[model samples]
Target: MCTNTKENDMDIYEFYSGRSFDAYRELGAHVKKEVTGKKTVVSGVEFVTYAPNALGVNVIGEFNDWNETVMERCYDGSFFKVFVPEARPGMMYKYKIYHRDGSSMEHCDPYGFGMELRPAFASIIRDMDTYRFHDAKWMKNRSVCQGSPLNIYEVHLGSWRTKPVFDEQGNPLTPEEIAESNRVAESWYTYKEIAPMLAEYVKEQGYNYVEFMPLSEHPSDQSWGYQNTGFFSPTSRYGTADDLKEMIDILHQHNIGTILDFVPVHFALDGYGLARYDGTALYEYPSNDVGYSEWGSMNFIHSKGEVRSFLQSAANYWLSEYHFDGLRMDAISRIIYWMGDESRGVNDRAVDFIRNMNQGLKDRHPSIILCAEDSTDFKGTTKETKYGGLGFDYKWDMGWMNDTLNFFRTLPFVRGEHYHDLTFSMMYNYNERYLLPLSHDEVVHGKATIIQKMAGMYEEKFPQAKALYAYMYAHPGKKLNFMGNEIGQFREWDEKREQDWDLLKYPNHDSFHQYMKALNKIYMKEPALSAWDDDPNGFAWILCGKENDVVYIFQREVNEDKVIVVLNLSGLVYKNYHFNYENGDTMKVLINSDWNKFGGSTKDTEKTIKGVNGDFGFDLPAFSGIYLKPVD
Candidate 1:
């Protein structure tokens, strides 16, 4: 074992001060090389860890037959290190920490880059430089995607699609036999295996980005990776760390941006994980009242400088090392307020940590996007941290999702009473640069799927859903839809099952898919809908006073490009419905949600109308939406 006196002291000081955003580079298991005299060289793996309260720490792994090798203490006896010449890439290892009271336990490395697949937990030594990225052009041109189109398809990687298990005869396994076997484990596609398939699907669906739910190592499959064990490690459920790099590289080559969901609030309570490292509550709160989250996990104690460094470093590691274009931070409300409860007042320390981390990340990567999945009414979520605000590029508009879905779920005859549900969003639309989301959270846990949440049964849901999407695209924000939503799947989202792909065999489902594709096309082609989304003047309500009519009219305009959107949510059709149009411009129908090709009653015909004497007239159909643009 050899010690390097040069950079160790400075790195440890920065780590303890919470200023080390790249702590993983210095703290994790890294292979080192030393030049001995003229051309002689020596190589070994160097392990480093921080356990301030521990009596001692030992390096134990495959290199030493799982035997404990005592590590040298340094810098006020808080940090430990050891060199193992036998250690190499692909070997599993862990730290054996000895407590002050003479107790001992083995814990995975806090900054490990790879982890063993659970029900087994071990940190794997990995060569971080093995995979060479070829995404220079994509990286050079990547931005925050502001003032541009950003339609994200949120996906849960494992359940997006599963491999079909086959028997020895090369036929697919019977449902019963598959169930009797370890089907869940057998059906997962490795990260490298799923890349091309996912790229093709996302491209065909016309989405510019894919936001993975979470890929951090967690013991339970049911948590959907929200509760994490290995903060810096990619989950072994998919493949190695390099395998994940290949997946991102493939997606980037296909001109698709990738976003990873990052959790900073809590961690899993697994015995071998970060729950009680060094036999103390080092990474989490000590008392259960504030320590345990609603999800039954340990809440991170962000007041500690080490924990702050660890979380931010992990966030930076994904963007810097794995080449993710963005990170959508999960549950910001919990970070802003204790247990996400406003009544508990604000968490000032956690709030400060967020600002500092975001500012630091922005300084490092100016082009990458940092979004928040925050539901709180916290001010300045998307504002720059230098201006006393959270430095996020975008924030999810949870209010709009709730109000709109609730309005759609109400019976149509009574919908007039809730007309403002559609209009209320505009009142606060520009509060933070928003991204309207129909995410996985809305379609799970006994809540119905987006399609099933519509007011009526069978045939009636299609037109309303079509109309709802048109409104969503027309609204002043970016977009994100869960994996199964575009196909109008009736089943709720489940982590274990793939989306109902067979649903597309039916006409209603197939037509909806086509409609979604066409809608995406229009959204992409029309700059008016997205180019000036954050500008207050970009959208205007042309007609919204008649609540009893249940008809809403709006216009979105950018520069010389403009589009008028009309929606009639009631069951009654209005013939020659006249609305004021001061410009008296000739208009052509762009996309009618009631068109026959999209499973609607109206014939597939392009209709044109002219505004005369400051009034424009058109036939309005029930449960329909129409987009019209002035003829050039």
Candidate 2:
């Protein structure tokens, strides 16, 4: 190792000091033009990495025939850099780190912009600045999702669409050495291939945003990109990084926003990963008790300044580099408490790190969203940082998801006892900005799909599911449903398989799908349903605390426009259920969840309810929900 050089060591100190949130661009392998002489210029790649404990570091790649002698460590003892004039984009590379104890290990660049596919771990040099994005209009008009309609369609990019194996080398398949390339569901579609299809489908279903389950590089297919390795690199399984940008471009062109699921708490325990890098627990905690996560991965040590810089830089890089509209941060409760166990008490260091990062990201990009999937009632999780809060734009309403799902799981006769589960959300609805999520977690690993979670037999579940979605869409918060939930998919989500697209052939499923589409369109179109979501003046419970009928009604009001939503969770119809309406307000049925088109008993009754002295009546259908709007 050499002594510290004034040139490279200056910014190196700032990176370790933790102020460099944009360290991804400064620390990674970047393409730069160097002047060899007064008139001569050379274009090459500059490789830099941080391994303070290593005795020496060298760059080995295709450019040097995998030889370590070509590029030596710079004068900075904690940092290494080498400029290769011959190195160009698409050249695979790795850093050979020699420990103080004479042990050497080859590791991928921590800040590399691109990575090779699994079974082969190496970072590739790719220039990110050249690609031109044509989303100027989308970027200019984008705003924070405080009072806007945000219906997100959560999708696992690889399994969202599996086409016949067209490009074998580029496809994400199960067996790496399988002889036969052609089979049923042979390969997962790349980001570019699926972008148009996903955009069209999401738009048709009335979703404004598509939240993809993580796109970062991971070795295991089963991890579904959650156990990430390359934070900056969009996984090679879905084509190059440029391809992902193009995909987002197409989505933005269609007026659809893109959100990437980010896992900042932990990382995979792969040998080539951040685990034991530089022959020490640099990124993770030194002890396994705190270091090892529940998912068999290593938890990031948020206390360390360098680690904080790395994680925060990774978060910023995705938004700035890829033009992502937002990040749905996964498992944020773990960051607040030790291993996500509230009993272990709050991790103050980690909590502070989260606040600082969120505030910093907000300062840099005011319009982008930072949503936390926190189950804890951590006060100020969604409050702005200036008010001593965690400073998230939105928080996943896990309480609402749990209570609603559990209520639906009960038999209709017993549902009256659990009716409070349906009404419990409003108690804390104003605490923080919330988004009701029927996420992928609710549909996998022995937890049945949303449709299957409903109580009763096959035939009985469809109507209930239809009513459930009606309630979800009609509820106050923004909405996010998993990939196959719209079509009422029965099977648990599998990473290897695509959604049950063929299920649309069945009348019940098709009708349920159509119902969701209609409901979503209405949710987006109706100002009463969407606008002023965060304001308490927008929502109110009309019918509650009724034990016998298991019926509920709510009013979503915006400005002068108001929508009355009625829900019947029981199997028996109630004739002439009386309710009050404002005088001179012309009320009509906007959407009947029990209509025949939705595989329900009721017909489309555009019946006008003429109110006398602020009173009205309606015959409620069994296992149905309806929306009544005040028309002219």
Candidate 3:
């Protein structure tokens, strides 16, 4: 059961359902009401819009009149939004729209808090009081959801694999009909058929989380799941909302966690389900300058009261309804574009939106993990909400990815291959609050395959090539490797074709995949490898030298129980590595990359060595890595 406390520190919870956060931390959640001028107003929310088309708009709610809470008569059309009222806990009502041509919109409830359960009149009446214990249960269950070295498997259901679509009633829906429904997700996948496979495979290979690429309902197919049409509704393409829930449930059962890539930054261009659903701007930006996005997504006017309330509620809804453990808010930096101040500065509006959403979750579920993908210079964007920053568990590390790729793309011995780029990656890896990413963006659309990238450098320089894979496991933060990366897949990832199975038939190429499998196994066994999976304290840098082979890192959590990965980039074996630690002297031989077990020559095997010190060293075989433990 969720804890009952008006004010309490967030608690960690675990269950088959996704993790939730306690909402009490979010004052906005408890907002009986607030007039902007009354407090130290945080950005990300306001009470204004640019509805030039609507003939007349009015604010309606439980406070105005129970049965006739419609505000149509009081509206002047431009932007008629009501601010948060004092002590109006869980206001539930909809806009009474007045259209042009002498027509009064009836049976129209855009922006309804809880809709009617009947057809044509969507039930929007959701009593805030009914959702009790969201934080407590959420916190407790998050404890059950363990964090490990993350290798995200980014998936878009419509195009992730291939499946069928069904109507709300469980009947088959034709492709053409689904297409006409204005839903962007024309692709599909059955949870029963996919989750188990993905879970089992991920666990077998050593990935910790699966980032479901934008599961929220949308209206564009070719645009991918980026354009959200319904923030609350799961796309009807792959399966029903219930099916998506079960899919996550099964993934958890398999000991794997899930990451929901949420897109509150903007709505779909068409704005079918979420856009103008309230007959006015319920979720668009305050104006085009702030709401318009590069991708044509309907920008959420983060500077409005109603939109702010709606987004915060939507964040909680997934946790309350579908059990989403975490959220990866897509393209947050672009949500609010700023013309003044620094070019990279984020609009203050985004700050408030993120803060309220996170606070609400923490109030009800402390165990909830929240991540945002931002490309702007939003300082402290991932700090604690109380610190006046967006309260997020983590943010995508695009800087590291870009730098590492630049280095990986370079041929060994090339001027750019100077340890500078690799060294730069290590320096900037932890620049953000949290990071664990391996998206389809790198492989698809002609970005080149991971194997191909390595082949560019490693094909001729096997030792350096092997170093890339080894360091990924050896790094001291959350890690993200795609599906085929576990075993070497030669070609880039493609939905249209199968992974490079032909390469596996050959001894050398097959060994690369086998080598990757061994790497994952050893990686999972090491605490150092997973320390940065969620928290900020899991990693630290020990050494960064001009020599590529001379770099050293500490997973901070390394202990006697862990499997220490030691690799040498030298072509010839190096003997008697200078020891650094001051621990016991015998080292346990775990496994070696050069061993035939991974399709390599048996160059050398690790022998237990004594250790205990601030610094440690080992004898490494040429072009290989070995796992070990300390012994007396």
Top candidate on TM-score is 1
- In model 1, state the lDDT of residue 48: 87
Q: Which residues of candidate 2, in runs, are more than 4 Å off?
A: 1-10, 34-42, 70-76, 165-186, 605-607
Most lDDT-accurate candidate:
1
Candidate 2 pairs with clashing backbones: none
Candidate 1 residue lDDT tens string, 510-579: 9999999989888988999998999987999999977899999999999988999999988789899989
Better-scoring candidate (TM-score), 2 or 3: 2
TM-score of 1: 0.96
lDDT of each: 0.90, 0.86, 0.54
Query: Model 3, 406-507: lDDT tens per residue?
Result: 665664445224556545655545555646455667777778766566534544333344566776656544555655654455566654333445566766
**Sort order, TM-score high to low:** 1, 2, 3
Positional deviation of residue 620's Cα in model 3 after best superposition, in angstroms:
4.2
Whole-structure CA lDDT of model 1: 0.90
Candidates ranked, most accurate by lDDT first: 1, 2, 3
